[model samples]
Target: MSVVSTDAIDKWLLNRKWAPRDLSAPPAGSDLAPVPGDPGMPLLGHSLEMLRLGVRYGLKRYETHGPVSWVRAFGITIVAAAGPEAAQVVLANKDKAYSQQGWTYFIGPFFNRGLMLLDFDEHLYHRRLMQQAFTTDRLRGYLDRIGDVARRGLAGWRPGERFTVYPALKRLTLDIATDVFMAADLPAADSERITRAFIDTVRAGTALIRLPVGRWGAGLRGRKVLEDYFRRSLPAKRASDSDDLFAALCHARTDEGEMFSDDDVVNHMIFLMMAAHDTSTITTSAVAYYLGKHPEWQEKVRAESLALGESPPDMAALDRLGTLDLVIKESLRLVAPVPSLVRKTVRDTDLLGHYVPANTLVSVTPWVNHLVPEYWPDPRRFDPERFAEGRREDKVHRMAWMPFGGGVHKCIGMHFGMYEVKYLVHELVRRFEWSVPSDYTVRWDPTALPIPTDDLPVTLRAR
Candidate 1:
């Protein structure tokens, strides 16, 4: 069972006192239009409902209030926008009205100065330098490291009648991240500690209380631990000519000869490590669950894997798993590893004709958009063929299937992430056959990132 810390309780009490008063009020007689929807409750507002209902909460609000709606969550009134129009407006940020500071309320403290946290010109500069680390040659080298680490990690999993796949996959992805990003073999104890730190940092984003105690406190502590770890490891990385991401970042320079400062490297590493492992784990677990439920799809993907014969196929062979690619896209649609992207309005903006004030938090619910019937036919069904050439449902909108997000601030490691997940799934299918009960349903714990409440139990057999 998950433990709630005392600091969390204290933080909750403090949050109630700190709750905003105009949560249910409209954006005050604007010439444009007011966004619809109630704040839901006093102090707590729609926060608990959102945490409990997850994607359903957003969908219901969208249906009731149209594309643009307002709800009080996390102690403030946030404009929740659904469907492709909202996604395009917010993600594209063509008006320069949205700022990445929306994440500041949640992850800014833990992941300060990371690329995603920057806006405008600063973001472009950092992104350009970081691009050097993800060039084709660099990605190929990372793929080699991912293959080796995934094989080693999978070798430790013992198949049983009932096995919880999520935790195992989480550890495997973290191991892969360590190998590819840091190029260091962490001892078992260190790996466990680092994994815990990453968990805390991520979970802290959704903490009910803003106080620096309990789960929130752990998140703060985790940030320091990561800072220390990266700082201590920096000198060695700076001196080495290693091909790993850490070394690349250390030596990364722009055509203008600009390079990241020591502080920048540590901050970016903490953020990148969390981003690299956490999203991959979520995507892999979702793929495993769907494959277990659909045996035909499983067999089809497995046959592709078996034909390769290589335990960890090379980049060219990995590309040839066409069926697996479809399954990955469908799985991402089904569970969307990073469900929603957050932004804040830097200046007053008009969204779908609704006047949104400056400093308002905005939530772009891509997960909700992924489920809208208008864009996706029979939205809940697990049909990878929707991604196939003939249907191409995702083509309905440029932002329709945004599991990796969209626009300039989209995930930098997206290609690397996809490669890592594909390799792990390929290896797993080749070595094991798994299933969940036909009637089984996964209840995701809606933290900052969604994870299965029961850790995604399944029956496994070694082939």
Candidate 2:
């Protein structure tokens, strides 16, 4: 081979589409060290590179600038902190330097006043009220209904040569969200429209432009559609004693005699429903893709599911899915559904000794932690055994394997999401044999939540 230079490789990876710029110097006599980074391009920054490379782009930044650095992307300067150490400082937030205000610049319009958008005492208050809906008893009830919906939805799959799995999983999850959460009698067309609306609203958050003609406009309209639907249904939910999530929210209360208002109920329901279906779909799809690629592991999990019998696993039965659980955990580490979290510095702060100014956009990337070799050996491989009882690589660091994130903002629905995935995957392994070609691979589109660009097709056959 001809000569290949290190500089050439760095140039290609840092393509940035243009030259990198240095961030502003630290304030006079701040004592903290100045952070090193490349700002990436001019106006657009590294937005396009990020959209193209997904979490993989973080590697380029980390390799070039270490754990703490400043870079420009998506029309703003962001302080990027990678690996477990950086993740710890941000998630722990011992000094209260970061605020949820950072997300307002992105998703506030579509998910206004949702739990993740609130902060400090307000966030705690809302989280406390919402906790009533996810009690242990309610979870058992939700699991029962989820099994029913999972059976009905999965039964409709045709088992084709080129089965587009992601869309199918997406549809199944939305059905679960609507049926278990809403418990309303809706026409097929109405539910379909609602699903399209949720898609628009979520996609519009990062749209380059907000003109009514594109994803932005459609998202605005979608938000109205959802708000109207939930508002109209609010009266019935408040009046009835239904056990669904919607009614639960309407009646949720604390021991101190607190409850949600009409607007509070509506806002929460919209956000919870979007989170329930979309993220679950992503996690479940990842589990399937991994199982398909590694047939030995597929058969391993399949045998266990088959041993459990097919009568819809109860909570105890779900707990017995040890192999499946390990596989799910590994898939989560390899492909974090949310990947990175955003925050804004409320005051000046130092991330691992690098000075960051007030109001600066900050990103703590858990995806980076998942792949760092020190935390996980063979991190890129499909190795669920890393999470086995004795091998527990994830235990090396508290934040090393946070697929649902951590700290106070950790996902509220994570427990339910796990149960939902177990039920769905249990049913799937029992009913069919699936696989991808040995040479096949899928690319996740980073435009939103890292969905498969090709919709992730695989070969499906009836068991």
**Clash number by candidate, in order:** 0, 0
lDDT (10s digit) by residue, model 1, range 313-363: 888889999999999999999898888899999998888888788899999
For lDDT, the strongest prediction is 1
lDDT tens digits by residue: candidate 2, 39-61: 67667677766766767788777
Model 2 whole-model lDDT (C-alpha atoms): 0.86
lDDT of each: 0.88, 0.86
State residue 240's C-alpha deviation in candidate 1, in Å. 0.5
After best superposition, candidate 2 residue 146: deviation in angstroms?
Answer: 0.5
What's the TM-score of each model vs. the native?
A: 0.94, 0.95
**Model 1, CA-based lDDT:** 0.88
Which pairs, if any, clash in model 2? Answer: none
Return the clash pairs for model 1, or none.
none
